[model samples]
Target: MFYQFPEDFYWGGASSALQTEGSDSSRGKTIFDVFYNLAPNRFFDGVGPNKLADFYHRYKEDISLYKAVGHNSHRTSISWARLIPDGDGDVDQEAVVYYHEVIDEFKRQGVTLIMNLMHFDMPAALQAKGGFENREVVDAYVRYAKICFELFGDKVKLWATFNEPIVTPEGGYLYDFHYPNVVDFKRAVQVSYNMIIAHAAAVKVFHQVVDGGEICTILNITPIYPRSDNPKDVAAARIADLIFVRSFLDPVLLGQWNAELVEFLGEHDLLPVGLPEDKQLIAANRVDFIGLNYYQPRRVKAKEHVPHPESVLLPESFFDYYEMQGRRMNTSRGWEIYPKAIYDMLMTIKNEYGNVKCYIAENGMGIQQEDQFRGADGVIDDTYRIAFYKEHLRYVHQAISEGVNCFGYHIWTPIDNWSMINAYKNRYGVIEFNPQTGERKLKRSGSWFKELVDANGFDD
Candidate 1:
């Protein structure tokens, strides 16, 4: 092996409740359920979350497959709606029993579990009441976190407050990709600020109730690059970074908002209001670690045209996406594949964020119509996916050699599951699932990953 990892390094994959577990009607409906009903055309092929990978009933089989693939650790999220049917009320006894069974199964397989308290699956009951935009929703989220801590924290040592906290506000409020499809900049800022507070509150509760458990949040950190060395372009990239990365990164990791971010929001009159104690709350409850979900880097240039003063403010208003001439791209998703961005991200964390403990929570390539890769031997020959993992893992190994405290690297998913807007169009799984028959087959990437895990690394 060219690049051996630490003996205790985590080797596994990640999945969320809504994406994998197929039990929507049994539990409380989420905003996703509501949105899909309202406009089924928005989703790919009109496939909703009603019936996903069926992990709810097939967790035992899934864990066996995970063990076969040499996964020493696994990450998954507990559905807020499933645990508490009404979003904020008495715990559902059935849900409690189900989760305990799942935890026990993982323990039976000797797989270390990293559980997230909330993914993007917010309960519709909460969404009906303005979701994160309302401060009351923060209290509701804290309550949910407390219940999770009291119930499952003893078994799950590693807990995440939320997964990609920025996506909620960015997609739902600003870009209209998620529920409540609003395009209000002020509401988006308010939602983002409230989510930070909610995360801090969850961390605070975790500390108060949980014993010997480490809590953190997963952030999708896409390093921003200037299109050119021009001063305006550089400034645009900086502003874009502040808006996308530092807005949540600073408060969670550094326990304070960046001065530049605050100034920019103030200048545009887009600051979230209320709770002078919010800063102290955030500072007092920093994460024990961080999770980086690196997929691609952002390339930005100065905006060619400024928006009218009366136009609503947005992060893209300060910068424009710059497409480089000869960049490697993922044709299925149209996302640039820059492996070095992982190294740069880790170096930034090491130099700027005090070298805090972190891990690659999610990273993988999603391809459309992957059935063509199957061979005569009944295996999917996903050599490109193998190469993608190798390239990214090389950078991860490089960062680790340089003393970055990254401990794990989990792929985006363990099995092909339903995506948000794309539905099941793109497959990012090591194991391929037959949507029609619910059949499972380990792909070539899965076999290769098993060898990599057993060897602790791979030869170049």
Candidate 2:
């Protein structure tokens, strides 16, 4: 086989409490539950988070399937609202028991657990108190992280402070897809700054409480591609990369801020206000490792027009999106299918970022109406999904061969689960979670993944 992974490399999938755990009655309300409750019609098919893969109740069976599919590790999340009920105050013993049961079952199945602290499911109680925008919320998050580390650190092999922390500021404050929707760039910068503080403080907590487990932060990096060879277009891509990529990446991995980003935000008068202590806290609390998630590449061109006087300035005010002609795309989600972006990103980390230990935390293909591909033999023959995995994994192996300090490869998920606004409009899992029948059946891609796991690679 031309594509082979290391002997002890992790091979499995990733899931979040918001997407997989079902029946919102047992846990405290998340902002997602509140948003879906307010406007179900805004989501696809009017389905809310109450519709999920039922991992809360069926995690044993789910773990068994994970082992059956030849998994050695799985990255999952612990719900703050589930574990603590509120952001602070009291702890829920019942939720603690449930998580212990789930973690024990994963151990029995010989699957290593990589637990994440937050996955966009902020407790509604905290949201009511200004979420991450307030310094009080940062302290509360550190408390939550300390509890999680002390309670479950013995069993969990690795810890991640936040999964794609940038998405919260981008989706909730910049865009309106998430709850507490506000489009103020100033507030978004504040929220983003506070999250960095929270993450750094959480990393400090993880080290103090946990004995030896390393902590990381997962980032979804979409490589920005310039429209042409012109210096203006290249400069636009650089700005976009600083905003979307470096804003989170630099602080978490390098323990410093990008001076250019600071200058840009200062010029716009959008810099976040913080205390004197935050700079040192962020610099001293760099992560033990990193997790990189990639799905698509973004194309950008130099701005063609100046913003109107009445319009609010945004990151898009500097760069315009360009859809390249003849580029491959995933028609279901309208995402570009440029798998080689993974290799490029890995190389960048090697050359510029000190080659910190990292892994492919997520990479997957989502297609609409997967039932259309179901075969008569009671399996979904998702060859396109298979092709997606093959191409992406090939780049991963190539990067590994070039000595990129990369380890492990986990897909977006093993079973289809609840997505915020989209619900289950697009399926990205190898194991089919049938919402109609409430049963999970292995897709053809699942079997192919098992082969990949067993061989630790693929044949040319």
Candidate 3:
């Protein structure tokens, strides 16, 4: 079988400022580093995002690698602290030069750049002022996004206002996975509401200034399904989906907040205060595109137990995760393998959200293997990775045929980048990196990707 992509189909990879660019540059300190610094071991494996794939110094060589590996496009984010050393006022000249060089170098290699303005990297200075909880922070983001658009708008055509805006509130406020770890539902709702406002502000600036630039919001949209055909289970799945995906999607894409979400929050008295002008501002600037980062689907069902003060609580305390029977799993990261999730996500977008153009902004498998790539004939054979990507692409091809309107596909990362708390424990790169000596090496899957890019499809 041969599944060929369109002529304009994009072949590229993704990296984040916080994840790939080491924090040692004049980028200053982000809230991520500051929070974990307050308590180092609070993160997974006791390491923060400081120890990253030092792309700060190696971007020249890395950009060259991206070109050599057959990339027509690449996605990367700019650290807020890096640009504004104070997070609000003066911009850093040294940081500006570095990023310009990186962006220019990519352009020289004939690669289109998709620049994300913020990717969970809040400047420590901004975090000092209550982060996303403050409306002042929203104003700061609009100014910052404007600066980026004015500076890089000519070269970069695509801009992302925020990456997975809900994840920060969910992980930091609701769940205990991220910093300022709190278990308050009201604060989570507040933070989420403010982030949406911030996103709308950025999009408004993008449309007003940048003549040809398009701004979109990136989301880690997970599809939720019920355990059985039971009515309660099905209803729970719909509510969870609303809270997770549509909560942000509706406001940004459809130019209005989800009425159901507002009604639900109003029932709990969790709605944030906003004026009539604020409502107009949000409804004016709708997104031109979407960036979908799909790795796993969420399988949920109605919760069996009632909430108690002593219970381990989360935002989704009303639902229970029901692992599908006989489902395949990524043993390395323990994520369920559900290829159909991507297809369903595309169809859902088309059916519910007007089939807006989108791209698979991030998709990759993470493993725990390190220093295990020895060659039989001078080549490390990573067949499992090759298979992992192929299976996903097949599904994407199916989506394309079904008129999903996806423009491109980007793997989660180009090189082995850092995770917030996981440190270097997980491997999710086509290009493997050596943490011991800061060496960069392409795995067998990297070569396979080059072939896939050259062919513009997969044949099996």
For candidate 1, the per-residue lDDT at 150 reads 93
* Global CA lDDT computed for model 2: 0.90
lDDT of 3 by residue, 1-460 (tens): 9899999788999889999888785778887887788888767677787777788898889998887777899989999889997689998888888888999998888899999998888888888898888889888988899898888787788989888899878877888777777777778888898888888888888888888778898888888889988998997887788789889889887888888878877876677866578778888988899999999999989988877867654546667788899999989799998888888888888888899999899888888874475576545567777898888888899989989989999998888877887778888887878777788888888888999999999898
Taking the tens digit of each residue's C-alpha lDDT, what string does model 2 give over 53-142?
A: 889999999998887777899999999999887888688888889999999999988999999999999999999999999889888999
Where in model 3 is the C-alpha error above 4 Å?
309-313, 377-379
Find the 10 residues in a row with the least total lDDT in model 2.
17-26
Off by over 4 Å in 1: none
Q: Compute the lDDT for candidate 1.
A: 0.92
> Residue-wise lDDT of candidate 1 within 1-460, one digit each (tens)?
5879998999998999989988656688898999999999999999988868899999999999988888999889999999987799878988999999999999999999999988899999999999999899999999999998999988888999999999999889999999989998889999999999999999999999989999999999789999999999999999999989999999999999999999999998898985989999999999999999999999999999988888877888888999998999999988999999999999999999999999999999999999898899989999999999999999999999999999999998879999998998999999999888999889999999999999999998
**How far off is residue 224 in model 1, in Å?**
0.4
TM for every model, in the order presented, reads 0.99, 0.99, 0.97
- How well does candidate 3 match the true structure in TM-score terms? 0.97
